[model samples]
Target: MKLKKPIASLVSVVLLSIGMATLVTSPASAHTNAVSATCSALSVDLQLYAASREGSPAEGYTEYQWTRTVVDNAAWTEYVRYTYTPKKHGKADPADASSTPLTDPSHWNADNKTYDNSAVDTYIHSGNGEGSWFWWIATTHEAKTHLETKWSKNEPAGDGWVKTGDSRFHETSPAVEAKTNHVAVTIDGTKVENTDFSTTFTKNYPFSDKYTSHTYSVVVTAWDDPMGTHGWTFTKSGSSIACTPPVVQVTAVFPEPVAPTCTTDGALPSLPTDQTGITFSWDENNSLKMVANADKGYVLTGATFNIYEKPGTATGDCYVPLEPVTVAPQTCQVGDGGVADFSGGSITLPTIAGVTYTVKTSGGEPVTITDGKATGLAPGDYTVTALPAEGKILTAGETGWKVGEDGSATITVTVGASADCSVVQPDSKVTSTEWADGTWACDATTVKQTREVTTTPYIWVDGAWVLDTAKAATVTEKQTRDLLASERTVCTEVLAAPPNTVVTIVPPTCTADGSATLANGVGYTWDKTSFGPGLWTATATVADGYAFDNGSTYQVTFLVSPKLTGGACSVSQVLAAPPNSGTFSQVLAAAPNASTAAVLAATGATPLPLAIVAMVLIGAGVVLQPRVRRAIFTRH
Candidate 1:
């Protein structure tokens, strides 16, 4: 019979000898001295067959040599039918049990004269269980015994399956294998140091099962964080990513960074051709930096830049995003050997002839402009103007221009100066002559006269010459005169008579000088000191005369006393006294001699008788005049 083994001890067996008459029998003989005894021992023994096996459990794998047996000490050999039962024991009867021959039979023990079958039920036990086997034995008599065997304390195979996927990536529900991956173990709710725990899971497989993919991608990546509203981000491959526990992947994607293009708010004259033409990077303050490549003699002016996020990108490890800012525009002249780092590649500024402007009588602030259009302007009648630069002029459009409501106006500026204007004048000449005032000549021949002349004046107006009537003087004349020699007045102090005729002699007086007789004797004595010692002049007219004309006038000049000689009574005239005629001369001759008259008159006698006697003596031609005068003087 098969026996059962306990958990902590060896198996207990209950053996009975079976006596069946209607079954196949071995022998039917009994001895009188032999007592009827039942089989009492039934046991199961275990032995280790192999320590390890293929496809074993992750915790531990084992194999063992197993044996089951039943034995009795009596010297009777019999046939028994044994049956294995998982639940019941000792119910098999020899009348109904199958009498199949054993694959391995019992052997006889010579020392004890006993029989035992230890190899009756032999199999590999992979798990722990409780089992039993029943047996029916036929002895040499009619008595029967039934036996039951049970066994326990067999070990189980494994805990469960385990996982063996890649460790670089994590999944929510992971794949596993038996006892190959670290599994958490916990007493209550707390975990322990249990990485070696495992389970038997059928879904665990290799990681390359999903690696074959199709897409257009590159190793280079771009990062962005516009205004730094969010953290840095970069675009990754659709087949690759990073993760934490409970998930894992093996393929690594290393992407290089691509250069971003430079941008501006205003329009540029040229654009970059490639990445090298304009490069965007970071500065020492982690700000965005842009550098450009420019040609010779080119310059950058009035260009500004700001940071912008590259769209549709995820942050990579090597890239960082910066805050948004607008970089101030810079001016760099490549011709002056300066760097074009502040500009984009190949910058060409728009040409503006004149940029200065003004608002005519408008007090508003200057308006901002974009592409020559005024912006932020209020609605009004705005007169927009374009002012010229230094050393230039508004030669064409000097007048103010009006702008439409849309602030649209065309300002044409010309750069130049205005024209010039000047002149020269003429010389003066003589015109006429006239007589001078307050002059003596003929009667009205020294009269005053008038001369006349003319002149014209001009002025300049609006680049041309015109008559200046307001400043022009009227026709004017000047007065002057010329003197004549015949007009000079002559003055005479004394008049002398002709010599040798009878005349009366005027004796010298106290206030007058004496005068001598002339041929036309006239008694004329004058005071010489009346006029000063100088040339005296007077206009002379002829006195009334018998024959000479008296209507004409002439000039006479007299040399007064001391001017003529040293004598006080001396005088001279440049012209003779007027009125000299033959009758006037005869009158002078009729006069007696002034010396004779003076001699007779000084005698103080009767002049008629004496004069008659003197005349008879003078007429008697020979009478000595001195003798006659002596007689007369003696007689007196």
Candidate 2:
């Protein structure tokens, strides 16, 4: 018979028992009591074994036996009682049941149900009519059980589960290894041991096989397990792999600055031959090296420095030679000290000589050759000299020439003033001779003189001879007294004459007291002091021999004046007096009577008035006398 153990609680056992079994001989004698009924029948094998072997017919039967060997009585006090309930009914006939041996404990506990086998070691009991009775067993042996608990299942309803008391029969679990780089594994069943495997094992195992294939989940949590303490979880799959960090590269870029070029024109500077260096500065900020080339030369826009030739070095071409004069004159004497003479005897000076020269006069005026003219000579001397044009000097064979035996002389021929002879005569006596008495004699003769005047001559005064007049007649002394006496007698006679007398006396023509008298008349003197003419009182004197007429009833006349009249007279003639005197009454008493006067006057009368008076008498007689006669006859 096959006996099955409950996979949840009971274990199965297998054992070998030796026993004698008799064969029943057919037709043989009667059997003795010792000849027991040899029951070589199959029995149920029962011992403590893993319940996983129950009901595995292919694994065959298992014999199990138990001995009460007390190793630890204290641990054995609480026994573990295992009971099995079979699902099938037990058969009454043992010959009809089948048996098989169980081999592996892994197959015995695999199923959750129990199986039945016809075995004497197992008791059967029924639970009313609910199910069939299988087996029940109680043992007092040391429990070989282990318990494993995860901290996640310490409290079943909360996050944990616990196995204690009757739950000690649970299966043991394998140990779980703890690791640093992977998920921690924990055993949950009894008889478990913690293993410290490598983290590589945790990575290889990933998760329990109940989860997805090729992809697994691990309990990565903070918990107290038999393995370790900490919390972590790693979920992995077939395609998951670790990634490497990326690589990077960095680079730097820089910019370059540009330099400037020189473009200055016409900037040649004067430098010393020994100059050491030249540094050029730019308007902008830059630094550059100067490279000299045959075509481009040196750049000067930016800064460029140069080291030059030394101070005393000679360079470049020499200066040009001085230009030559175009037209130079020949060598000639110049200035005032040098003398130039005419080569020939009749040389003339040039009209436009440019230089100065000394012109010496040999036998003529001292002439100076200046402004092309010979000056400073008198009129007579310069009349033979000539002059050149302005600004020229006398040269040899030019303006003038030298005569024979003369040295360097120029002849200036010019007009001169005339000679003056009026200065030769001075103010001296000039006489004229007349031939009187047939001899050469000088008498005073009147000669008219004139003046001779000139700007160049001395002054001349009048110096001619003059003549004198001859003297007149002289009177005698005896004749002069006779004439004076006759004049006195005539004056006395004239004084004695009376009023109304006419007396006439001739003047005495004689001399008195050395005075001359007249010869042609008498001398008479009168002083009619208080009376009219011909009535005189005698205060008259006359020359001797002159008579006085007094009371004679005659006219008196005296002569004391000159006889000359009505003409120019000389100084001696105008001063002479007449010698005659006459009475005024006698001249008045000699008048003729009227009728006799008319006859004598008729001989000397004017006929113009007589003729006019005769014409008026004739007209009046003819016009008025006849008118009067006619008027009278009418009246009668």
Candidate 3:
């Protein structure tokens, strides 16, 4: 008969009994008080582990030791000592339970339960229950009584398996061995303490056979409440990880942790690459600083930045500083340089704060002062120079200054300007022209602004603001009328040779100063006096600042046709009477365009041209002929 004890699944238990068991046969005829019995075999196994085992991890690891024998004392005595290393996260597995047996104590002693089979069974099972179930555990007196009462009843060894007490195959010891591991829990890298952790587990015990295992259950829980939302999971292994193990190990494995997430805000847009964490410093009154912290194993990444007049944060009035800040420093001012205030007072610059200027001493290094103001300046002579912007000049401060005993002194520079000048233009009286009402009839005359006053010349440069040396003149200046071209009036015919006609000529004129302006001088010359024949035109030209009053004119007409006459004429006396004298100096001129032949014909000279008639008259009268032939046929 055998009792059972739970087996620790984390450890592999194996028990080997090496000592020989003595076989005692019931003597053919037992003495009235003698007894003897024979046994078959004996063994024990132990496999145990703590809550934290291989493939299992918690706060830390735990250690265990086994100091017991795995051999029977009534049979052979032998034992092994072993120790289990603490679980190192997932690396938690103890060596197998193996021991060398030796015949050390072969006697039975139930009084002490030591140096016996009970010790061996206890060592193998981590407890006496399961191991003892498979061991020969009866007391010395019970063993003798059991052999006499059941197997020694005159039964021989050859008798077909007679009842030997209640037939038994195994027995067990009383000692129980157990182990425990520390319960630990953690999240990320932080430990979880002060919390009870547990897990439900079953410990199987040994069978009725000497070498089998027994089982029971022990519940343990491991948990970590770090940042409750850290999100963690727990699982058991070595049993049903993916498949069930023939011998359960009850291993608890915790997978690698997922880094916890921490959302950050108010970080700088542009962070340096090397520095993943941020630290800031500034005065809240004027400026702000922002920084960012990268997650573990990462560095700050760089980013672009955009400047703005104000932060466009949605938290309206809520302002949180990401870093410390500092404010700008204050400064004092003395004066500025510009156009000297020539207002009779001290010609000096004005005061302005925080403006920079460079002060250069003759031989010393240059020093910069703000607002042209300096306090506790090294005593010496120095020339203050203005570092004005480009395109600007030091208009107000250009002289070197001596540094007086006064520790506080000022210098300034100025900018901006302009100048003015005046000159007089000579004024001349503008003449009012009395122009006759013009008639536009083909032959009628038309008049215009025929003459203009000339501008006066002055000793001055072009574009210069000249100062007038004398008063401007106000007088009627006569215009110089120069004849530039001439034209004549055409007469058709006035006898053969006509008298010259005197015309009223009006010359085109301009001011004398026009020569300064016009490359071509101005004026028009036309023949208002000389009147004659065929064709004519009035031409005009101009100097600078002047133009012609009128353009060139078209052709005029001239004719030599004559007219008939019957009344008395100027040359009638000479014609009626022949010239009695030696000579007649003149002949009568004909009216313009009249036919002289027709006129003489009307005088009854002849029906021929005047030249032929004159020839006939001279012949008749000089030779004192009786009559002129051309007149002979007339009705005188």
* RMSD after CA superposition, every candidate: 57.1, 68.6, 47.4
How badly does each model clash, as a count of residue pairs?
Answer: 56, 115, 72
Predicted candidate 3: what Cα RMSD to the true structure? Answer: 47.4
Which has the better lDDT: candidate 1, or candidate 2?
Answer: 1
Q: 1-636 in candidate 2: lDDT tens per residue?
A: 133444322332211111111222311122111101112211111122111211211322222222222232344532222333343565222211221112222211222233333342343445554443333223355656443433221234432233432322222443344322223333222212223222122222221222222221223221222142211222221212222222332221111222221211222223222312222232233223222211122222322233322223233222211111111112222222222211112112334222223334445434455554444333233323333333223334433444323222334443233332122343233333331121111221222223322222222234212221122222222111111222222112233332212122222112210111111112223343211112222222333433334222233332222122233423221112222222211111111122323322433322111100001122211211110000111100
Could you tell me the lDDT of residue 416 within candidate 1? 21
Error of 3 at 61 (Å): 84
TM-score of each: 0.16, 0.12, 0.15
Clashes, model 3: 72
On TM-score, the candidate that comes out on top is: 1
lDDT of 1 by residue, 182-216 (tens): 22222213333233212211111112212222221
The digit string of per-residue lDDT tens for model 3 on 1-636 reads: 132333432222322121111112222121111111112111111112213333322232222221222222334333333222222533333323342122222221223333443444322323222222112233232111112233233344443334434333222333332223222322222333223322322222222332222221222222322222222222111111111113322211112212222221233233234432332223344343332333433344453222223333332222111111111122222212211221111112233222234555447566544443433333344445333332222233233322234322334322112121233443432344442232122222222223333333343445432434363333333332222222112121111110111111111111100000001222223333222121222232333432222332222122211222344333322122121111111111233333545334434332211111111112211211211111111110
In model 2, the runs with Cα more than 4 Å from the true position are 1-350, 354-357, 360-365, 382-415, 418-499, 502-636
Give lDDT per model, in order. Answer: 0.28, 0.25, 0.26
- Model 2: worst 10 consecutive residues (lDDT sum): 627-636
Give stretches of model 3 more than 4 Å off: 1-275, 278-294, 299-403, 412-417, 421-636
Ordered from best to worst TM-score, the candidate numbers read: 1, 3, 2
